[model samples]
Target chain A: MRRFFAAGLTLLLVCAATALAVHAADGTVYGKGVTLTESVPIADLMADPEAWVGKRVRVEGLVVDVCKKRGCWMELAGGENQPAVRIKVEDGVIVFPLEARGHEAVAEGVFTRIVLDDGLGEAHSHEGHDAESCRKETRPGVIYLIRGTGAIIR
Target chain B: MAGSAPRANHRVRRWLRVIHRDAGYLAVGLTLVYAVSGVAVNHVADWNPSRVIERVERPLDLGDVRTDDALVDAVGAALGIDTPPARTFRATADRLLLFWDGMTVEADLARGMATIETVRDRPVLRQVNLLHLNEPKGWWTLVADLYAVVLAFLALSGMFLLRGRQGLAGRGKWLVGAGLALPLIALLLLRGGP
Candidate 1:
């Protein structure tokens, strides 16, 4: 009876050790990069895009939208009238459903440029007007688009 | 009666041990895959997972480019359009319209120039993302359902792995209680319950 009890105890210890190892490995593999706080503003990101490229950085904000089909893009609000940055899901990253919108999040990933247009000409033409009219209408709402890659949506 | 009872008890314990060990090992990798992907998917508005690698501008000489077949062909050639343009229009006085890959582009007529931008999805994570949704259909959905069932089993079996004071009756009970309470507390604090 004593021998049986000792053997059972050993088996339980082994299982516990295995579980701990698995959990530790996951944290090491996926938890790469730095945390984001309110002090680190969008202006700071724009100031040094090259250095931050391909490096994971976290940002917190309120979600505005999610893709109805595949979760391709999500809009995050910074402040009122401030152009919302549309966060794109990295190729393999899976985000949750639309219910997550309006929820605050801290996401980590590399910041990259997603310029929708190289010039203002596309914006001007879409409104069915000349350069002056396009400039008058589109200029006010112009937004510079930047996307993050390998993002973990928290 | 006692002899027969011992044999049956031994058989039951043996089967339980085998099932617990095998299932635990099989679930390790899959558990992490789904957990990480699920968290990322849940918070979509926070970030883009894909990266835009490069953007280039190529100049073309359309030379009085008009809103006709010839102009479209010239524009297509200059922009390196792999397939026929999905749509084209007169975007403005100096620009012509073109659309591809869920985006619109405008080319300058006189300069024969257009900007070409390409975005490539991030590797590994992109495929994992697809698995998270089981979007491919047929076999994938079946696999996802199986995974869900296994997860439920894991939760249940895990409770019985230990016994006695340090096991489910004492410390184990406390651990399980804490696990349940954490999620309940978060739901109450964050969403105010339903």
Candidate 2:
């Protein structure tokens, strides 16, 4: 009976630790929490997003915008004239607070470029926003974003 | 021998009833949270379940605020907001955005308009929705999984709680079949099910 009590106590403590780890430090960790150490400048990534496609990279920048509907994505500010790079996560997997805009964030994810066909003639919807509202499209058709795995917003 | 078999069956049914009742009691709180949040989330396409957002537009005349610092100070003064914004971004030469906790300002430098949007958590609903959505993962995941198991057990045990015409072998079976068929029918109608 004493051994069983001890084991139960240990399991509870482990669970407590896991819960604390999700919101551990000064910053709130979302999803699995950013793991990559090296940083890639948002400017550089936006300038040549295609080269980084399919590769996991970490980016640090000011959170300029977030998905208001679902908290599924955030736009990180790039350089002076460069458009912000979007870090898109699967909805509900990670919820970026609408208030996270303006805070500094570090996110790790695989860079991706989604090519839209002209034949479809439909402007893609980025979760809630219609094509007219989606500002991240590379040109008239392609969308460039990071398929985010985790992030830390300070 | 027939009496013994019925007696044993009655004893098992009694035990099942006790278990089902206790489990139902145990599940009340979490069940309420999940049920309410589930309905709110299902209609997420129509509204935000966790936060309430309000937007207001105010006119402000900041005579030619050129630099970033000047713009922040001017906007702060006009809005009577003493606290500095967390960050500011220049979306365009004519547009500047200032952000604070639960609040955002979109300033039209060309037109002297400030659109202030404030977001607030929806009281008890927000807290329950967080648990329902599994936002506080880790330990909560285990809690949710355990709740799911408890719910399954309660459902199965409930079928055996009644006997005769009201039991699984009678009208209860038809009710259960209808309950199961609804989802399958929905799948066929909506997703062209396998």
Candidate 3:
């Protein structure tokens, strides 16, 4: 009887420990879809992003930020003077990890510039929760995006 | 009249029993799947419910590893795997990362240490958990809706299964009421909090 109780206690402890690990996002993500054939440095692409617009090209760079809510997109740093580009994946398809910041990543996608309106621009911000805040108006500057089909992060 | 009423009651009870039992039987497989995965997922901290992460460590003889290719080759040779990485990058002077589908290798150039980490789907758990997770879209969602209908049918059929002293009018009502109250009480307690 004592042995059975001890075994049960051990099993409970093991299960409890396992539960805790599932809560946090593990800093790991699998590569999605095709391994893109060619990659360009983020610095070079930022210089002539328009040239690569609508073209599928891979880019490797240091990841600066990731969406805290859903891992649907990330921002990768470019050259010192260049604006970091956002890499957006289709929702429920390929999810980027929230813990991918500071890691080097290679993404392959179409590079395009989007003109932001109050509705669309605020949809991409972190604090744009409510309908009012999500509709926060901003000047229509170019929002460079590398809408990625596949990615590898480390 | 008395005999006819008893016969009608008996017939209704028989049909209800058949429906409840059959529905319960059909739901057994899904119930077990949901229950097992549910328990595993609830803890969220102790283990990875979706994938089992397999880790292997090795020491690389980084003799002349200067370029990214050389570093990948060294790690690959250490692990004795032939496939080239999907992507490789040097994050810092001391660190290099090689990525493949479901796998990652980190090389510490300064320490000559290398580690390969891979994730594997956890057998039955992964498949069942997919339904539990609602990550699988499209037709599977429709199947889940069907399952919900079965559940509602079972719950309603069950309430009508018993009669007399052992029925909903007696001890059974108290049990069912407690079952309903528990979740409501928990919700109330949690409403003002996190």
Which candidate leads in lDDT? Answer: 2
Off by over 4 Å in 1: A1-154, B1-13, B50-63, B76-117, B192-194
What local distance difference test score does each model get?
A: 0.54, 0.82, 0.68
Worst 10 residues of 2 chain B by lDDT: B185-194
| Model 1 TM-score on a 0 to 1 scale | 0.46
Q: What is the DockQ of candidate 2?
A: 0.43
Q: Name model 3 segments beyond 4 Å from true.
A: A1-154, B1-10, B54-59, B78-83, B86-95, B108-112, B191-194
Native contacts kept (model 2)? 0.47
Model 2: per-residue Cα lDDT at residue B88: 81
Query: Chain B, model 1, TM-score against the native?
Result: 0.69
Evaluation by lDDT, superior candidate among 1 and 2: 2
Q: For model 2, how does the per-residue alpha-carbon lDDT over A1-154 read when each residue is reduced to its tens digit?
A: 7998899889989877866775556588898778888999888887787898999999988787887777888988754445778888987899888878888899999998777554333333452223123333333457678889999998
The alpha-carbon deviation from the true structure for residue B128 of candidate 1, after best TM-score superposition, in angstroms, is 0.8
lDDT of 3 by residue, B125-149 (tens): 8777767765534345666788889
Q: Candidate 3 falls in which docking quality class?
A: incorrect
